[model samples]
Target: MHNITNGPKVIGTKQTLRALNKGIVETIYVAKDAQKQITLRAQELAQSQDVPIVFIDSMEELAKACHVEVKTATAALIKN
Candidate 1:
């Protein structure tokens, strides 16, 4: 969370999925309380691409950590 706050990051399910497919993201953060449909897909993609997925408690917690007002189901930390 701290790392993403200080660096490049893409938030939301669609954006994170694109980043994962493009292999631009080094790590992914998924909200544990997110919808199963969304989280499962993201997790599968991360595993297929060998990207690390860090699970956070909830969308509220994750969004707060990212300094965003809206809840975020997922986010990806992009490489430099």
Candidate 2:
């Protein structure tokens, strides 16, 4: 059984990025087929924040993890 809640942290781009910059991001998961620019930005953000990045098989999985319907990309920022 796959569980997004127990899997990892999840965040968006705009507001979420701010949180990430504040050291709230633990790990990030992007859709494998996400936009190149968005993915690149996420990569950069993760790198700058020293967070790990992973590409899941589908956006659906990422969305579900983010508690959305169809999110193209998402960042896992959990509070420690």
Candidate 3:
């Protein structure tokens, strides 16, 4: 998504889950290549909250989308 690179965002599963619990995440991006255990809880929480999810091909790609240097299992765009 074009919005991910510049929008206010949080990267990695822990941070994403925190934002989701706080009700501030607009959308979540998950890397399919990541271990399921690493991403499962966040995905379930986002679904329960009705947040949209966009799947990325890999952790590296997700990092790139989030404009981060290190790979991440997930990232989220914070609600404006």
Candidate 4:
């Protein structure tokens, strides 16, 4: 969470999935409280690509880490 706050990242499940598919994500952060359907695809794709997945406690927590105003189900730190 601390690291993601200052690094290049993509927010939300869709954006994270897109980055993961493109092999640009180094690590993905998923909120444990988010709906499985909303986050499962990203998790699976990250695993397939060997990108690390870190689970935050909730969407609100993840949003704070990303410095976003709205709740986000997932986010990713992109490779530099």
Candidate 5:
């Protein structure tokens, strides 16, 4: 599998949702302490789209994975 963890395709919640609707998202990562409603919505969206979801321990971890300083949530969209 491609290492999107440090690639240029990482996106935030809004963009992620848009990508999800387009069937471009492969997986989503949510911070453990993220808002319940947001996480739930993301889960529902991913489930409906058949995309995988992961919950990380912190925003810092998600940021690291996305190669950013900090990220509350993100989704790794399919490359091309």
Candidate 6:
């Protein structure tokens, strides 16, 4: 999605979770095939924070969409 480009973003699950927990994420992008254990908490946090979550087909697709060199399980676009 266009939102993934040219914005304050966190790539990978850990950073995404940290940003989500801190209430700084406006939206999160989760790989559709990501591990439930990893993405589940983040999804819950995002829902609680009223942030939107978008799902890509795969981790590789997510990373490619973000133009990153490595696969990313999740990512967040920061608030404000």
Query: Where is the poorest 10-residue window by lDDT in model 6?
Result: 1-10
lDDT per residue for candidate 3 within 43-68, as digits (tens), equals: 99999999999999999999998888
List, residue by residue over 1-80, the lDDT tens digit for candidate 4.
36789999999988998898889999999999999999999999999998889999999999999999999999999999
Error of 5 at 76 (Å): 2.4
For each candidate in turn, give its C-alpha RMSD to the true structure in angstroms: 1.0, 2.6, 0.8, 0.7, 2.5, 1.1
Better of 2 and 6 by lDDT: 6
lDDT at 20, model 5: 74
For model 4, the stretches where C-alpha displacement exceeds 4 angstroms are: none
What is the C-alpha local distance difference test score of each model?
A: 0.88, 0.67, 0.94, 0.93, 0.70, 0.89
Candidate 5: global Cα-lDDT? 0.70
TM-score per prediction, in order, is 0.93, 0.73, 0.96, 0.97, 0.78, 0.92
Which model scores highest in TM-score? 4
Q: Summarize candidate 2's per-residue lDDT along 14-78 as a digit string, tens digits.
A: 64566677777777777787777766776787898777777777777777766767564665656
Model 6: per-residue Cα lDDT over 1-80, one tens digit each: 65887788999989998888788898999999888998999999999888989989999988987889898889999977
Which runs of model 1 end up more than 4 angstroms from their true locations? none
Please tell me which model should have the higher lDDT, number 5 or number 6.
6
Model 2 alpha-carbon miss at residue 35, Å: 0.2
lDDT of 5 by residue, 1-80 (tens): 22557554655777777777777777777778767776677778899877878778877677777777756565564646
Clashes of 1: 0
Question: What TM-score does candidate 3 get on C-alpha atoms?
Answer: 0.96
| Comparison by TM-score, 3 against 6, better one | 3
